[model samples]
Target chain A: MTSSWLNGRPCDGLPVHDRGLAYGDGLFETIRVAGGQARLLDRHLQRLSNGCRRLAIPMDTDDLRNELTRFFQVLGQGVAKLIITRGTGQRGYALPEPCQPQRLLLGSPLPAYPPQNALSGIRLFPCETRLAEQPRLAGIKHLNRLEQVLARAEWRDPVYAEGLMRDMSGRVVEGVFSNLFMVVDGELRTASLVRCGVAGVMRGEIMVRASQHGLAVVEGDISYVELLQADEVFLCNSLYGIWPVTGLAERVWPVGPLTRKLQAVVADLLSDS
Target chain B: MTSSWLNGRPCDGLPVHDRGLAYGDGLFETIRVAGGQARLLDRHLQRLSNGCRRLAIPMDTDDLRNELTRFFQVLGQGVAKLIITRGTGQRGYALPEPCQPQRLLLGSPLPAYPPQNALSGIRLFPCETRLAEQPRLAGIKHLNRLEQVLARAEWRDPVYAEGLMRDMSGRVVEGVFSNLFMVVDGELRTASLVRCGVAGVMRGEIMVRASQHGLAVVEGDISYVELLQADEVFLCNSLYGIWPVTGLAERVWPVGPLTRKLQAVVADLLSDS
Candidate 1:
């Protein structure tokens, strides 16, 4: 069952003039819930706050946290999707003066994925839809995600678990719904988010954990050639933890030790509370 | 007063799971309604139809036209805004299977602009916000318009009637709410929509009318330096018709003969029906 709230009230609809729908003037976060708690909630909130600041949307994070605490009790063990919009506005693109940001929270059952996706591994589709270079809108998870929707639409075959997207400059950036990482010659590497792509919560956590474990994690350009030449590649998101990418097109890879170690870290983090 | 309809029903709200709000997975068109008629509606519908095709959003244009005829009568003389979204969906970026497209029609009073804007011309603000190049999403108006919102926000000073935006490569594209054109060396020029920009219905009309009158209408890249060197500049949209650009930062131009010619064409087009 799915439950939702608008501004702390149990509602399933928003005003037609809401800027979130009018111009996609908003930000969103999809958080994992386990043991009646929102996992990595601080990171999610931090990202949300950052996005709000970047877009100039006023938000009271303290109040948001309080509301989520109550919401988690109702959600229990599931996924919490939160959207913060500039709220209802008069016609036009000009930011509403004295903007009243709307907070929407929805709790839904965790998506069921095949067990083999985490164990044996999953296949990746090379998406033709390229991420446009826009440093101004890069990193933070804003609502302007047509590129992602188009990329995900490129395939319907269940054999490919995810689609890999490259930037306009032909650099391997990320998956349709997750951040990507590859183990390259003993160095852990991921594409830089300076030009484009979302700076995912799990991606950040993995970087920190890898660094603490004395691993060299680099964030920079990763070409398709460089990615295919890597020792191992993996994908990560807040909900599913980490998915080992075993195949892309005709190439195949065995689950590497580095990916296993990081997956274990994510599992421990998510299972704790 | 502003009134709205959802899926041909008199409603003011939508389900929270709408992909329009979630991912900006939709297209929208703002049309001018005059004398109980939707002016230049066929062109607007054509653009919307083209957008729906590119996004793979199933739409019946004939059905949409029938609905608008009734809506225009109710609207009388005002602006008709239509939004076609991918409708409600489960949490994910992938296109919904068996998708139900939502048609939202909003009728609101025409925006009141300074009379001097049309008579004497208007000043333009060169926006710092740069449009990202994406061929797949260019020309057709989509809902992911954070860039426009940000650019419009750059100037609250009413002295500047509109803001001009360029692409990442520093090629001047369009106005915050209108399409831009310039006259250089006796030839009409507008930024090509192949890279990135909303190809406004009025822009298309102006090009055709100019060609009919035996004027050289060209669509290609326009650099800031080239724009500054142009003999005449103007901005246009379906609602406001045409506003000759009298000034940009530290520069000014008289409303030239060609601008007057095109403005007359737009004025006649909007006044009829």
Candidate 2:
């Protein structure tokens, strides 16, 4: 069984009526760890706080920082999950007055991905799963992930690594968990999160990296043609760091130099985390 | 505490790593019970099974039916929540191999809409919250309800009965928990589920009733203008049946005759259940 920590207390089970299970009223951030520290921890907390404000869930950053520090202090190195729910509420649709705000800090062992797959890249299926545009919940990693979970369940083979999703308008949005980054017209571009998509932490980091290198960054509809024309492509999330994609659907390409350089940068961040 | 039943077993607690909490990878149906019987039991079950198939969650309906029958036999009269999740699995984004299905049935106290709210109709706020379109997950009563929960949380006044949502395109969708039916241009119309709305159980029943009465039923984009132009507007869910809207945004309307008549139709079915 997986271990758990509810509100900083060790617990074998969740309380009777966790709203996370009841209504999915919560936000989450999955992070990677190296050398006993979470990569981009501050940025993730910033995103979490921003989400809480938009959703009206109160957040205590000081307490959160301390709890998270202590959480990772014991883990040594691995992945950590921060889940904050609207907490328990009375039986109704209305947000309970005086939200008790539940917190769950979980640590898990990371799976090993072969270096070959990491370098040569993996296959991605262009999933028919379309993300609905909800700007309020867009950009934040919340608990309403059933759409992605269902899309991922569409396949069973380990041959496929991840699926690419598009918004209602058929514009490429993101991977089920990771953000999509591609090089098009000698420029780095990622799908816009203005309407629908998670503003991934790693995506943000990559944007900063691109800026540091003075690379032109575009944010808009990324079509199939643009994707195929791209010199390199990679999918990124906190856990996997960065994985270059060799192909998606029937289209195939060799792992380009840019993808490798980006991976090396991400690896450095991981090494120092 | 609210009462609960899991797989016909007696009272207990939830597992630490329920997929429902992890990924919202589950489907739920809220059944209305009156004197040892569920309202629209067959329809709700059909939806549950359809959702399981779409999510690739294998469920033995006969086994579930037996458990459900036993649960209701004990509760007699109340609301029973049937929850089916993709079961427990190792962490990460991947779908579980040989998926384990977990069915949880929880009995909740049936809520009665306030007599005043029911009779005089209720006020609804046009929520800034928009429903993202994920047709694959749309219409089904899945556990990824963070959107609805967030929309409902957009306001906290007990004075407001519910909140109305829109799609990314600014088209009116439905109330947080119910399907919207409006009389536009002297004809009946409801928000289309093709993009991002739910095909609610009560919505289906209302459609049938509308057909029997020879009312024109148009399923399409419902704008705020269409809502304003409507002579009558009402919300429908399996539990509350049908509720008329007395006020919205800057406009107001008395509960109309057609709304009352259609509500009576739903009332008869619930009484039968």
Candidate 3:
């Protein structure tokens, strides 16, 4: 419940009429914390900045960073939340003119991800809910997340960790809360979010790691056939790090080497935060 | 900017950390106000209650009525907004067990519609953005409204009142801010929002008016072809009353009798408040 502000004052809450609450018209990020610091805070900032550009929301990175720094500096550990919303608007759907953006940085105790989760991985069910194809909104962490919310609610058992979502075209998109990656023919590959999937920060990190390891990375319309035949599959996010996909519906795969190697770096990145 | 509360302690502001902002997971109703009373207050309350039932959010009708009465008492004339959110959850998508819903009511100045809008009508553009089909979420106004936000941002012109939106299946749904209807065979009809679009309060009133006049009222999939051939077209919401849609792309329609007659009754209802 702790907060830091961008207006250089002790701000505790969002304005009552914030459009974020009114319309889910905002974007956000969840960064992992380690050693009292958010890992790759700059990269996360870059994504947030990119998101603002896409949504035409004004960006003040310095103000954001300072507020975020203060928030984390107080908590010293866990997850750092960065939320930017088009402050408030009237009842109409029209975007309010001269809108003041609401900036919020909340620090929370991180959910403990099992050490084995990163290395051993988890099971996933293909959700009935489909992520609508909106190339413009694709890859950005916008607040219009009812699709994800509905998909996540499909399961109640603690046994299943996450659910995989499909695009309107019935193409396997990404996990409800993480990015999807698979090793195909010894090459590291991820689903193309050009149609609809979040361009996650951890997904970016793993891509970088793939390049650094001399593995050619590719993104495109990856079908279920392409997925099931893969050497290995994994899911990732900034908070959960990287997790090998041990089973998906009827197919199961062993935790592979590439997933482990990439996850090792993600672990170090989070642990060093 | 003015507000009222049920208990009458003091209505200064709402907590910043309300779940409404945190998740964009709330429902709201914007009601018309005039001469110190709310218009269609019962219908608005019904919509809110129906929305709460669908989302599993708790509803206390008596307390809500007291709050609404107190809210209108503070505002001599304006709009009343009632927002109810499934209270705050942790930093995740999972809904909390035994959640308490937060209620926020705010009264503010309503936008005065251009008188010429009733006479000259408006220009409309078909947006590229399409609403996804979610029967459970459709009809009711909910906080997960990024689709509407993006659709609204597609155009920015004072001359044109609003833009038209379609569902994924090429079926014309509704305008970004209001429910849409047309007169065909001298019968009044509107799009069925069972899969998308909101079932507006004014839409129901218009339907009842048509029924009282023994005019056929159709509610089903409305495609562009059927809409283009319609005798007249218009849009309506509780706040704006009725606005004749003068032109759609190249097609033109003068304000028709049915549209005008219904608009008169609707306007009277609003002004009576």
Candidate 4:
């Protein structure tokens, strides 16, 4: 069963005139819940707050915290999606005179993925769709995700778990929904999201944990050649934690030691009280 | 009074699961209705069809024509918005299988713009926000319009009637919601929408009419220097036919003869039975 709420009230439908539908004037957060608690919710909220501030979308963080707590308690164990829209507006691109932000909280059962995905690893499909570099909208998980929709639609084969996307300049950015990390010369490197790609919550956590573990982390452009030459590669998101990229195109890599260590670290975090 | 409908039925709210709101995976047309008819509706429909085709969204042009005609009949005079979404889907970026498009038809009274906006000219603000270059998504008026929303929000002063946006490469693209044209040495030039910007219906109509008028029309990059050096400049949308840009920043131009001529041409086209 799924639980849904709109603007602190229970509802199934959103106003057709909502600017979120009209112009994608909104941001969303897909959070993982374990043992009746939302994992890294503070990080998610931090990113959402930052996005709202940058976009000038009004946000009541205190109220959101209360709502999230109440919603998570009812949800128990599942995935929670929080969508905050600019709400209904007059027919124009301009911000409404009095903007009442719309909050949509939804809960759904965790998707079942093969255990092998985390254990052995998954194959990657290099998508042809190149992400446009827009600093203003980049790094924020906003509603303008048509590029991702197009990239994800590039393949139908289930053998390829996720597709990797690059920017217009041919710099490997990230996976369709997850962040990418590669270990080169005993150093962890992830694509910088300053120009494009979402600055994922799990990505931030992994970077922090990696740094704490005395592993050198670097964030910069990763070309296709650099990615292929990397000793180890992996894809990660809040829900899935981490998945070693065993194969991409013709190049293949065994589940490396770092990948196993990172996975174990994330697994421990997920299980913690 | 405002009238709204979702998928042909009178309703104010859309299904919460609509992909339009979820991902802005949709197309929309803001059409002008005058004398109980949706003016330039064929052009709008044609553009919408092209957009749907480019995005691989399903379209029933015949059904849309019938719905538009029926919707126009309900409202004597005003602006009608037709939003076509990819409908509901599972929580992922992938296209939903056996997709059913949802059509939302809404009507609102015509906005009250100053009569002088068309008679004399309007001021333009060069927005700091740059449009991201995305060829696959450019030209087509897809629902992902956060850039335009951000551009429009850059200014609060009513003195500037519209905001002009340039792409990441610093080529002047278009106004927030309209197409831009400049007359340089008796030749007309507008930025090519190959990389970005919406190809406005009125802009298309103007180009066709300009060629018929024996004017040389060029669709290419328009630099900021080229803009300031132009003899005449104007912005056009289907709803707001044509508005000569009298001033942009500190640069000023008198209402040139070509601007007057184009306005007269658009006026004649709108008055046609």
Docking level for model 2: medium
Per-model clash counts, in order, read: 0, 3, 5, 0
For A30-108, candidate 2 gives per-residue lDDT tens digits of: 7776666788998899999998988788889999888888788777677788888888787767877788898887777
lDDT tens per residue, model 1, A121-188: 89999999999999889999999999999999999999999999999999999999999999988899
lDDT of 1 by residue, B1-273 (tens): 377898878896888999999999999999898878988898999999999999999999999999999898888888989999999876798788789999999889998888899889999999999999999999999999999988998998999999999999999999999999999988999999998999999999999999999999999989999999999999999998999999999889998888998888778666735
Q: How large is the interface RMSD of candidate 3?
A: 2.3
Q: What is the per-candidate TM-score for chain B?
A: 0.98, 0.95, 0.93, 0.98
* Model 3 error, position B173 (Å): 1.2
Runs in model 1 lying further than 4 Å from the true structure: none
* TM-score comparison, 1 vs 3, better candidate: 1
Error of 3 at B171 (Å): 2.6
lDDT of each: 0.92, 0.80, 0.80, 0.91
Better of 1 and 4 by DockQ: 1
Tell me model 2's lDDT, rounded to 2 decimals. Answer: 0.80
Interface RMSD of 1: 0.8
For candidate 4, give the lDDT.
0.91
> How well is each residue in B1-273 modelled by candidate 3, as lDDT tens digits?
466441344455456556677666778888877777788888888988998887777889888888777677778788877888877776677776777777777777888778787767887777778887777678998888878888888887776788888987889899998889999888777888888788888888778876887779889889998998999999988887888888888798888988888777666776644
